[model samples]
Target: MNLALHSVSYAGVWPGQERLSLEEFIPRAAALGFKGVMLVAKRPHLSLLDYPSHQPEKRQALRALLAEHDLSVHSLAGYNDFTVGPERPDVPFWEHQIVYIAELAALAHDLDCPAIRIFTGYNRDGLSYDAGWTSVVTGLQEAARLVADFGVVLTVQNHHDIAVDYESMYQLLSEVDHPNCRAAFDAWSPAVQGLHGNELAAAVRRMAPFTAYTTVADYVALPRYRYEPALVNYVEEPARMLGVPLGEGLIDYGTFFDTLIETGYTGTVAYEMCSSLRDGGNLDSLDAYARQFQDYMSPYVAKANAGVAAATAR
Candidate 1:
């Protein structure tokens, strides 16, 4: 139950957020009392272009930088969609993504990170659900094989449209059937889907065995409406979710963490403010949000660790 902060929170991926380079971000994360960090493996951070597999020096430098702050890299977050270019079969998009992940795997190995977080494909128009599912399963199998030699595990997050639900994610991992492929489950998606109390606990327990990692973020839903001039009324639209500080939003991390611990999940729990936050995403706001996660989760992590220690003593 080690706590880590995601670099995306300060990478300015979302509008209004102030960005920080990996060099600057490391010290700040350490200062915020994180045991490790989950780095976004792209531009303004650890992009493959900047730290290519051929460039061992860059990887070593980054590793030394993290060590300088006495911090570890919990995981490297990668972006890929297995079903991209469904219409352009000749483009070899899946192969390209596989190679991209392979490179990230190499980078992770050099950085001493154990896992890399990736996503299944989003549903494409004209593509059957079964087709998308098969593409993701096979793609993950190949990616897992590619990274196996590097000793890096590929963690498929319960994100993207292919297998977002906990049940589907479990099925996806089972079908992939690779030793290196595992789950990177998160609380945000299940919370948004209206899972709470017993239901949320069930989902966590089901995924716990396969889950190698998880990320935490809190959000409040903002209801939307569309004006229908012809009817002279407002039509209800889907709600927009805005990120908030931990414990202040719709997510029930209390239940989430309790289940995780009960199921013997000793994996990293990363906090990320990956979207437009409630307050403006200035440096101050970002720092405060990151600190809030530390303040909130400290007790939970402490309790989990104490339980483990007590069990070992027995």
Candidate 2:
């Protein structure tokens, strides 16, 4: 249960976010007591274009900086939408993604990272479910084989439309059938889908074997209202969400972490503020929220570690 902060929090993609360069981000995370960090493999951080494997000078410099702060690259986050247009036979979208993953795998290897986070493709309209599922399975298998050479694992996060739930994710990993393919299972998706209590724990427990790491964030839903002029009434719109501190949101991380730890999960648990947060996304607010997550997660993480220590001692 190593606590890590995702660099995306300081990437400033969200409005009003106070951003930090990678140089500034590493030390800040160390100061916040993060044992490791999940570096986003995009611009405003470790861009694959900028830190290619050929650039040993840049990679070595980054490695030196990480060592200076006693921080590890727990994982590298790669953004890939594996779903491609079924109509465009001329397009090389799937091949392009495989190459992109290879590049990131090399980058991760240079930084001594063991895993990289990725996504299953969305189930886009106009494509058959079978086709999309097959594409994702094939893509992941290829990516796994490519990265296996570097001893890097591709941990698929449950964030997209395809293979999003526990059963589907487990099936996808099995079909991929590569030892380097694993899961970056998160509670957010299952919780949002109304899985809680023992149901949630069961899902976590089932996915534990393939789970390489887990990313954590919480959110509370805010219902929306729409004015209806004809009826002279307000209609209830679907609820939108804003991010909150770990335990304050509707997500039941207690059961989530407890199940993972019980199943012998000792990988990094990362915190990310990928959306508009409860407080403003300004620098002070972001820092406060990040620290709060660390505080809330520390005890659970400590308990897990203690259990591990006792077991090892025995």
Candidate 3:
């Protein structure tokens, strides 16, 4: 298992986090001992507007930078929601996203990245659930076909609303039925959905076969309360999830990693600090968290690698 530091950790999307350019991020990730990186495919990183497919020079420069740091780009993360404009049916939003992914796929090929991570659609007010499902299925099918030409696989992460659970994500991948389409499964969603212990292990096993990539971020749920002046009391509200360093939060990564290893998942596992974190999101905090992930996952990675070596020896 190749450990990758996702660029989003330093992309400054989270409050108080400082943004780092791809040039700055590459060497820093190498300094932190990561074997590779997972780049966020947007501004402050590898945006299409910045690294257009026609601009081979920019891609080459970026490739050279990665080589200088002895780092490989394992995957590129893309942002798209196929059910965004259900009310505006005439807008052709789906087509626009498909084209966007195609361009990203081209960029990934140039960067020597094998996969592009994408999400399914969120539930829309004007669209029925069935309609949203169909939109994602067809959209992924087309996107998968488009990226295949570039030798880039489209990894549908279980991040969005359409098919986030393991069962539904498995069904979604199976329904797409394209060789270029695969899973970028993560434990965060299932953990938040109250799956744990044996149940969580089951979920991982169910999606293991289809999973080609994954991202890790530990989080703790902070319970909230609302003031009710009339009743002179506080009303309990839904909890707010906050990110934390790996192994310091509620996620059962030990179980998660054990299952992945047992199932022969020797794919890229990326660490991301994409949300408001408990220790705040300054560069020091981010680096510490990143280092913590590296420390936490080292043994599991070593065991997985040893298993692969043993299999080859036979």
Question: Count of backbone clashes for each model?
Answer: 0, 0, 0
TM, every model: 0.98, 0.97, 0.98
Q: Write the per-residue lDDT of candidate 1 for residues 91-152, one digit (tens) a residue.
A: 99989899999989988889999999999999989899999999999999999999999999
Q: Can you write out model 3's per-residue Cα lDDT over 1-314, one digit (the tens) per residue?
A: 98999999999897798889888999999999998999999998889999987778999999999999999999999999988887787899999999999999989988889999999999978799999999999999999999999999999999999999999999999999999999999999999899888998999899987999999999889999999999999999989999988998898989999999999999999999999999998889999999999999989999999999999999
Clashing pairs in 1: none
Q: Which lDDT value does model 1 have at 32?
A: 83
- Over 1-314, each residue of candidate 2 has an lDDT whose tens digit, in order, gives 78889999999988878889999999999988887999989999999888877779999999999999999999999999788766786999989889999999999988999999999898878888898999999999999999999989999999999999899999999999999999999999999889999999999988988998899999999999999999999999878989998899999998998888899998899999989998978878878888999899888889889999999999
Q: List ranges where model 1 is wrong by over 4 Å.
A: none
The 10 consecutive residues of candidate 2 with the worst lDDT sum are 81-90
Write down the lDDT of every candidate, Cα atoms only.
Answer: 0.92, 0.91, 0.93
* lDDT of model 1 at position 291: 90
Candidate 3 yields a Cα-based lDDT of 0.93
